[model samples]
Target: MKISTETRMGRNRRNPREERSSFLILCEGPTEKGYFTGMRSRRGPQLDVDIPKGDHISAVREAVSRVSAEYDAVWCVLDTELDKMLTASMLRAAQGSSVELGLSTPSFEFWLILHHAKYTKPFQSADDAKKMLKKISPFWSEGNTRFSDFADKVDSAYARAQQISPDGKNPMLNPSTSVWRLVASIQGRPEAIGRSTGAGRS
Candidate 1:
């Protein structure tokens, strides 16, 4: 059998601009890690996950320390949970660094909830967000939900999240999330950043 050059190279040929970028995602929760892990497996991005101890601020500090370690980018998946003071501190910590944040108000579950429905109601606590998410996705459980659970709805969730807030500038904003930015990066659609519009089908 004869083999063509296209078959040999397959779909591995990426332009200079399309070259795969490496990422270091820092988060504390298992659920966030699980979802990003699933994305890494499927999306083919050069990514690494780091679970740091302590609060979201610590995660930002960790990202700051690691951002210069040769990775193309570094991000923190954090739940601000209506704590403006803490959120402000975190933002301050990341200001001079290349550390990006996938911030969700009340909890990361709210970001997941966007996958199923459009909601903008503020939750007082992480538990409140989790309870609401359970009502929407009855099967959702912390640390166990994988990307495949709602893989097909990524574009929808991205659109819904974009509708809620335009960017990561306001982590203190209630019921808001910038997780869509991280999702866009993982999808190799970094141009989607700050785009408050259309849904890009992944």
Candidate 2:
């Protein structure tokens, strides 16, 4: 996408040029923000990242508050296994206070890929999953794998990640039920991660 990063400078009120915001990225923390920065810009001529730095919850809210006409799309990269307090906090932080929770069933697969690549720290930041990207065909394309190819491998990989007795739970490695459901939905299938809330204990 074509992003322009010339935010108005120092109270210059009447300058038409200063009315634009040239920055493009808005991330939960400096790490993910850094993830974008560390990557080779394949967009070459068309891509420029201006992601802002904010706590995951607040950053998402702030970006949504901005006009969509201003940027390509606002991505709120957040965690799935949130505790009640953190959940409430993020929901409260959401723009207009609308709470929507969802995730992909095999979210860890994504994290694993990032971890293997070290683009993110395997259990904590997006950097971790960068590791797994190497197993895919698009080795040099910066997560260039087509969605079509990666669809079937999650269950097998998740089983492996699930078995890992890491000293502690890898935050980035944990998969959310919502993410699993999202993947199912994308395949034109039903949600398959967990029992329905309606499926209470007998």
Candidate 3:
């Protein structure tokens, strides 16, 4: 078969941006990883987040094992959307095999998103959610994002709502809430080091 110049030119088109992008390894929960990973596929194709399966020791270790080579920085994203959780997160991030780490969670609300009843509807991208939180929380200054503000806003918002979700499995609102933290470490909007964040997402 003969090929024309147009066909050759079409084939010549290069996805340089895709070729240049890098991937990242993170072990939080599935939802958070899914949200962040999903967002990256859209905005930062160069980056990817690995989600660890199950809570088994081996799985966690496996995630850590890959961190050394697959990713640029280590992150611990979770849905603390259940009962008061303060330590489980620290433990997961510690297994980072000595890689540097960043962690985030919603307030007593568990996760950072607004949907709880269905866990699917009203789902927004990670970047969009981060911007939402900044708008809601005063501890945050819109452009400036922080996990602490996330916790506070979550906690305070939960108090005002006067209701608790029965979802025992994925307590947190998914890691989309922490995208800003992930972005800040590399390519991101200018932000403060560590302050309370905004209310996050509508």
**Which candidate comes out best when scored by lDDT?**
1
Tell me the tens digit of each residue's lDDT in model 1 across 98-201.
67777888788988999999998778798999999899988888879799998999988999988878655667778888888888877867675554321111
lDDT of 2 by residue, 34-90 (tens): 443443233321213344455546655665575355442233434543244554555
Q: What is the C-alpha lDDT of each candidate?
A: 0.79, 0.36, 0.41
TM-score for every candidate vs. truth?
0.83, 0.36, 0.40
Tell me how many residue pairs clash in candidate 2. Answer: 42
For candidate 3, write residues 1-202 as lDDT tens digits: 9999999998999876645545465555544444444444454546556656764244445545666644444444443332234435434545425443333334312234432221232323444444554454335342333344344343343332223322122224433134333444444335423422321211
lDDT of 2: 0.36
* Displacement of the residue 194 alpha carbon in candidate 2, Å: 25
Could you tally the backbone clashes for each prediction? 1, 42, 19
Model 1: lDDT of residue 18: 51
How far off is residue 193 in model 2, in Å? 23
Model 3, global lDDT:
0.41
